[model samples]
Target: MKGVVVGGVSSGVGKTVATLATIRALDEAGYAVQPAKAGPDFIDPSHHEAIAGRPSRTLDLWLEGSEGMARNYARGEGDICVVEGVMGLYDGDGSSTAMVAEALDLPVVLVVDAKAGMESVAATAYGFREYAETIGREVDVAGVIAQRAHGGRHEQGIRDALPDDLDYFGRIPPSSDLEIPDRHLGLEMGAEAALPHEALSAAADHLDTERLVDVAREPPQVDPEPAGARTDATVAVASDAAFCFRYPATIGRLHERSTVQTFSPVAGDPVPECDGVYLPGGYPELHAEALASADTLTELGERAGEGLPVFGECGGLMAMSQSLSTTEGERYAMAGILPADVEMCDRYQALNHVDLEATSETLTARAGESIRGHEFHYSKASVDADARFAFETVRGDGIDGDHDGLLEHESLGTYAHVHAASGAFDRFVDRLR
Candidate 1:
């Protein structure tokens, strides 16, 4: 599919709104739009999926290697793909928007905040483009999207100020209706706080859909990975608001090898009968009270004790722990399968691309195997004195400063969220067999 990167000059520059408007514009212009995200972000992609009506491709170089990221992009289905960048074009330690754009060889439509100044917005866009070469990165900052810009003189000034090389794609006018509500994790899930369709459509009307379509280009071709061999084992995945921070590709990977079933713990559903269970990350703390009264985690604890392979990540880790103490000082009992008490903090405890080496064989990796993932959470886990950890932290702060992957009775919980490209899910499926 032909694609273009919608990058920002900096964070909070209305990139998500611009990208959503761009998607709406493309869809209105009779094109199938595929949305994708640049970093290891789940929230932004949720908004993308809401607008594009498809799962947004995750294109992080750290979680998934260059080849893996390319393959992920190759899997996207659409005539035109709009990738929303993370932070800024050059920002990020492990993976940046520039890296993803360069890897895909896609031209970037820089989103410049033109709310205040038009000439300065053009100058900022030009500086970002020129700064690419200074950093020895081959990023094509092809044009600028004047975000929160006005009509007449304001839009004209931005257009006139652009250099010969930079194109003026269009402008996203200032609108209070375009704003998405924010919380600790970032913007609330798109399903909860998605902008009104009328407002989004109005914003879309301002974008230059023709210019965007013309500038979009396809990334390099990649050999798609063969589907995993199917197994009889059924894997039950937790899929409610509490456990919603899962990558679409992770579920796809699981489905390739097993019968995937989803149940909501927040709504008091019991865990399904399955050989294995997968609990992803999300706002478990927010629903801790409901979870405490739910029977799902209790049943999961019993099943886990019976040698059923269970893996939980981040919020899943919290849900699988002994207890969860919310920031409000309320404590609730969790699954008690892992020997830890999780407490929600005002500030994020760990936020980075993670590298882990399995010190002992676990559901996701064999002994001594390295795994790449991402961790961004606000809870801290206090483990038992004799708690058994399966993995050693190599590049991030795990549960402790040095270790992660709390293991007990064939169940494993970790703060890091692993991608299917890391071979972790494949290993989990193999263990289920």
Candidate 2:
């Protein structure tokens, strides 16, 4: 599992293009390539999956922890793994990409938008490298790939500005066709609108493959075992477009221990015969009306009433509410299990690094146990005082003042999005078993 990280100076810096291009290049070169996105983004992973022919997993230090990251890296069986960074290198709440790099001990390839002069570009790279070092991660600046360089002089300017020790990868010329379409959530994931294979091949042609391969080093190896020899725990994973922020590593972990089944809330799908349900995060507000009228909501509410163990995060939490009102004020009845009303807000409520102290035994979370994760959503819910669960204290930006996980019977719902590597998933499975 050799790894390479593609980071940018800031948002819109072409990390996605670089990541996809690198994955395609490696795959074309006959290397078993695996892709990993840095943050809790669902759309980017979809694109990664389209290119890699496998699901792209997320590695968030805040949510998955150091051990989780190591386990995921070790488990990912690939000749070369590419991990794409979010926003910028040091742009996470408390655990940034630099932190993740340090946790996994992987080298980084900095992608700078060279629309500006050379000296400024060099300064930007210098700042990122210094920041990575300041955080105690001695990240090897494998090389710099310039995007949108003006003429050939932009590369020279960057070369003149950078230190003699830094390596220079190639540059990607500006192209209107290479731009990926975006929507309110992020990039459009429909098959028709996906990035063309030719575009990815062109980007790969521009990148210095030899340099990237040189910097890429394999992760520590772990023994692989035969499947289906594990316990009989069933994990119910949400699988609709509205709530699809799941990581392949999470699913793999569940499958390693027990049988994993998927159910959708959009088709009015019934909850399969399972001991526990794992509802991931996604854009639930977009389909609030359909989810409100779906039979799955009613069935989930009934299960919650029966004390079935259910855990939901982010948009899943919004769907499990009593009712949902969209940003346009379109109201729809929801599960009515939590006695809470969710209203989609015009402002996006994105928060990173949520630390919680569990106050109850729901989902096997012991009282006084603390867990770390992140939250990104646009809907706000108002819970009745009598219906709110007093399980955990949340310390994050989106959480108003102090917040706790909502509990109804054995169900726990909240806006905090957790990684599958977090012990929470395993604990929930074990409790159900």
Candidate 3:
């Protein structure tokens, strides 16, 4: 396997579009292309799956352990693999995409938003490559993709500023057809969401796909012993357009320890008979009415009342509330697992990272244990005194008084989305087993 990791100087620099386009082109060229995202993002990976015809796995060095990162990269059994960087090349709390690249020893293809100042772009690229070096690994700046170039000035400025070692791979001129729609959580995905096939096709046509693929190291083999005998534990995962904020690695990890079952809250499906249930974040607000009226909510409430271990994050947290009030002030009854009334707020709540301390034992977590996760949502949860379970604390700057994560009875909810590879995640899941 050989490939190039595509990263932007910052967000909105067309890295996702360029990455998807590159993957599409490689797939078209008969190369087995596997796509990976750097952080704990679900939407971009969903879009990558749309283009690459494969599920995009996440490789967050902060969330997933170094061994997990290496294992994921090595699992990219393709002629070419494209790893898309999150926020920025070196933008992460403890570890970042640059660290992942270093761990895998892969080359990087920097994507610059050329609409901005071009004269300083070279310095930015140089800084990123240097940052990679300081972390004990040499990084090759294979080339740069100048995005949103207009009037050729941006490209020319970038080319002029580049040092002799770096190459200007290609440019993608601005086009109205290329814009991806966004919401509070991020990009929306469904059968109806726009796929941007033409835009990706055009971007792929301009990049040097052959050269980029030549640098990707081969993926490693994961021959973990078959999962041990199935445990009595079962987790109910919500799977639908509205509730799809789950990492494949999380599910993989869960299955490694016990049997896992999936159910959709949108379709009014019954929660599978299981020891526990997990509702990862998604767009429950968008489908507030349907979910509110769904019979599944009543059933989940019934199950939770029976003391089954239940957990929700972000949208899932919202879904498990007593009521959900949308931005329009429309209210809908929810699972009522927690005595919390969740109301939609005008502003978005996007907590990127936090230090999580377990205040109570709900899932596989023990009291006083600490972990790290990210939280992003817009729902404000107001709970009654009786249902509150204070099991976690945020050590860093967090939303709403720097206290993040929520606990209610046997149910756990939080905006902080932890990756499966995190030690906290391992401990949490171990308790579930």
Candidate 4:
């Protein structure tokens, strides 16, 4: 599908608003808009999916290689894809928006905060466009979207000042309604707090929808392969506000080989009867009290001890631990599946692309095989000395500097969040089979 990257000058520069507006504008122009996010952020993509009416493809070169990222993009069912970029246009090492654009060979429309100046916005856009050439990056900053600018003369001044090479896509007008609230993990889930449709429609009215469609180009051909090898294992997944950081593609992959069941451990649900259980990452810290009283935790601990294969990532890692002690000094009992004490932190412990080389055979991967994923959390897990480890960290922070993937019985707990494209899910289902 044809795609375009909605890049920003930096974080909090209105990239999400501009991208949402662009999606609304394109959809209004009779195109099926598929949204994609440039980094390993599950939050921004929530807003994208809320606006676009579909799951936003998570494209990160570090977690998923160029081909893997392309394949994820190829799975989208739409005429065009609008990728909401990460921090800045040229921020990350390998997972930057520019790198994703280069990988997909897609054009970019820079989102500049036009709240302050007019002509200066045009200059900033020009710098982002030419800075790519100076840094030897294969990026095409085709146009500019003036964000937080007022209508009438303010918008006209910004448009009139733009260089002939850069197209004036449109401006997201200044309004309090356009802003999305945030928490420790970033913006609240779009389902909880999405911008109203009328505000998005207003921003779309000013954009050049024809030009957006004109600038988009098709991505390179990707390998059409499913996430994991097929198996008929029943995989019970933890769901609800507490354990909600799962990808649509990841669930889709599990459905390809397993009967997927979802139960909320935070809502006092019991663990379902299944051969395997997949616990995703989310805000378990916020719902610790409820989770402490859940039957699922005790049931899961027992089942995991009995050799039922279990895979937990991030918040899941915390949930399967001995206990969770919050920063406010409140202590809650967890599943006790892994020999570790998880504690909430004042700041993020790990926030980047992660690489883990399996040290031994684990529930999710075999020995010697590497898994690529991302970890972003504000909690620390202190493992018991007798606890066995399954993976040695190659990149980013794990439980410690060197090791991740704490192992006990048939279950594995790690801070790394891997997608279906990483082949971890395949290994997971294969192990269950």
Candidate 5:
């Protein structure tokens, strides 16, 4: 599919709103739109999926090497793909939006906040376009989308001020309806706080849909790889608001290799009979009360003790711990399978692309194997001194400063959320067998 990157001049530059409006405009124009995110973020893609009615592709170079990243993009289905960028265009160290655009060879439509100046907006867009060259980056800032720009004089001034090279796509007018409410993690999940369709349609009407379609171009084609060997092993994945941070590609990989079943632990469903269990990262802290009393966790603890392989990441790590303490000072008993206590912090405890080398054989990787992933959470774990760990932190913070992957029984939990492209899921499935 042909694609274009919607990049912000900076964080809070309304890139999400602009991208949603662009997706709306494209969909209304009768194109099948595939939404994607340019970083290791789960929240913004929630909004993108809600609007586009499809799972947003996770495109990260750190988590997935260049070939893997391309494969993830290749798996997406649509006539056009709208990749919403992370932070500023060039702000990230591990996997910047500029790098993603350059790798895909896709044109970028810079989202310039036009809440203040007009000519200055064009100047900023020009600078962003030329700055890539200065940094030896081959990013094509093809045009500008005037975020929160007004019509008539304001929009015209932004459009007229643009140099002949930079195209003027359109603007997202300022509106309370255009705002998505956010909390600690990011914006509330799209299901809880989606922008009104009428509001999105109104915003879409102002955009140059034809021009955007013209600007969108195809990336280099990747030869499809043959399907891997399959297994009869069943994998039960936790699915609910509390455990919603799983990547679509992760589930897709599991489904391709084994029988996949899902149950809601937040709703108190008992754990399903399966060869293994996978609890993905999410907001288990928000539902600590419910999870504390969940039969799924109870049975999961029992099964884990009985040698059932279980793997948890981030929030999953918190849920699988001995206890969880909320920011409000309420402590709840957790699954008690892992020898650690988790505490929610007032601010994010750690957020970065992470690399881990297995200090010993674990559920996801073997001894001496390295796993690449990312961590973004608001909680910390107080692990027992005698607790066993599987991996040594090669980069970023883990459960403690030096280690990650708390190991107990046949289960392992970590703060790092790995993508299927990294071969972590493959090892996970193999271990399940």
Candidate 6:
């Protein structure tokens, strides 16, 4: 599909707003838009899906590799795709936005925060474009989207400052209505704090729709992998507001090997009849009382005690713990499947790319195997000192100083969220059989 990567100079540069406005501009131009994210950012893609009306593809080179990223891009359905970058253009290690642009051979549309200066924004975009070549990353910083710039002289001055090499795509006017709220983890989810439709449309009116589409070349072609035939085994996955941080690809992988069943613990839905359980991450802390009052955790505790394999990530790890306390120090009970107490805090405990090596055979990985994922959490767990951990840190901050993967009975829980391409879910699926 034809696409362009919307990158920023750094964090808080309004990449999400620019991307959404770009999507709206493309839609205004009568293009069926498919949105995607450059890194392992599950939250931004939620906004993309909200605007695009389809699940956005996740393209991370570190987690999915070049071939896997291409495959994921190829799976996206639409005439064009708008892939939003993470952090700055070349900020991340292997999973940077520049890497994805180079891997897919797509041009980069840098989002510049132009709320302050005019020529300075152009100069900053010029430096970012040139810096990519010095780093040996073949990324094309094709254009600039002036974020928070007013129409008349403001947008004109920014446009006049750009050189021949760089094109001025458009600007997102500074307005409070376009702002998305934030919490400890990141911006409040897209569905919760979405910008008004008129705001997006007005932003669209400011952007250069033709130039934006012109820079978007078709990504490198890769065939979509065929889905495996469904198996008789049922894999129960948690959904609803609490357990909602799952990647679409992860669920697709599970369905390839088994029947997928979904239930909401926050809604008091009991754990479904299944051979395996998958609890993805979301805002369990905000709904701790409802989750604790549900029969779902009790049933999950019982199933784990009966030797059922249960896997959890982030919020899932919190809900599976012995107890969970909110930021106000109000405590609520959890599944009590693992011997740990989770407590929410004002700041994130872990926020970075994570590499964990399995020290022992676990539900999702063999002993000594490595998994590449990411962890961003506001809660810390107080585990029993004698509790067994299946993984040791290779890169990021884990549950403890250098370890993660709290394992008990047949259940395994960790803060890191892995993609199916990492083979973590593959192992989980294999364990079910």
Candidate 5 lDDT (Cα, whole model)? 0.93
Q: Give the poorly placed runs of model 6, Cα more than 4 Å off.
A: 223-229
The digit string of per-residue lDDT tens for model 5 on 298-417 reads: 888888999998899998898889999999999998888999999999999899999999999888898999999999999999989899999999998998888999999999999999
lDDT of 3 by residue, 227-329 (tens): 4345556667788867788887777777776778888889989889887788888888889988977899889988888887778877888888889999998
Cα misplacement distance, residue 133 of candidate 2 (Å)? 4.6
What order do candidates take by lDDT, descending? Answer: 5, 1, 4, 6, 2, 3
Highest lDDT scorer: 5
Over the full model, what C-alpha lDDT does candidate 6 score relative to the true structure? 0.90
Q: Against the unseen true structure, what C-alpha lDDT does each candidate score?
A: 0.92, 0.76, 0.74, 0.90, 0.93, 0.90
Per-candidate TM-scores read 0.99, 0.91, 0.88, 0.98, 0.99, 0.97
Q: Where is model 1 poorest over a 10-residue stretch in terms of lDDT?
A: 190-199
User: Root-mean-square deviation of each candidate, in angstroms?
Assistant: 0.8, 2.7, 3.2, 1.2, 0.7, 1.3
- Give the per-residue lDDT digits (tens) of candidate 6, residues 1-433: 7999999999999999999999988998999999999998888999998888899899999889898889888878898999999999888886999989998999999998888899999999999989977877788999899888888998889889999899998788888989999877788887887778798998899888888878889976777776665667889999988888988888878887888999999999988899999999999999999988888899899999999989999999998999999989899999999999999988878888889999999999999999989988988999998999989999898899699999999999999999988988878877887
- Clashes counted in candidate 6 amount to 0
Worst lDDT run of 10 residues, candidate 4, spans 222-231
lDDT of 1 by residue, 283-395 (tens): 99889999999898898998888888889999999999999999899999999999999999999888899999999989999999999998899999999999999999999
TM-score of candidate 6 versus the correct structure, residues matched by position:
0.97
Candidate 5's C-alpha runs over 4 A off are none
lDDT of model 5 at residue 57?
A: 98
Candidates 3 and 5 compared: the better one by TM-score is 5
- Tell how far residue 152 is off in model 3, in angstroms: 8.7
Global fold similarity of model 3 (TM-score): 0.88
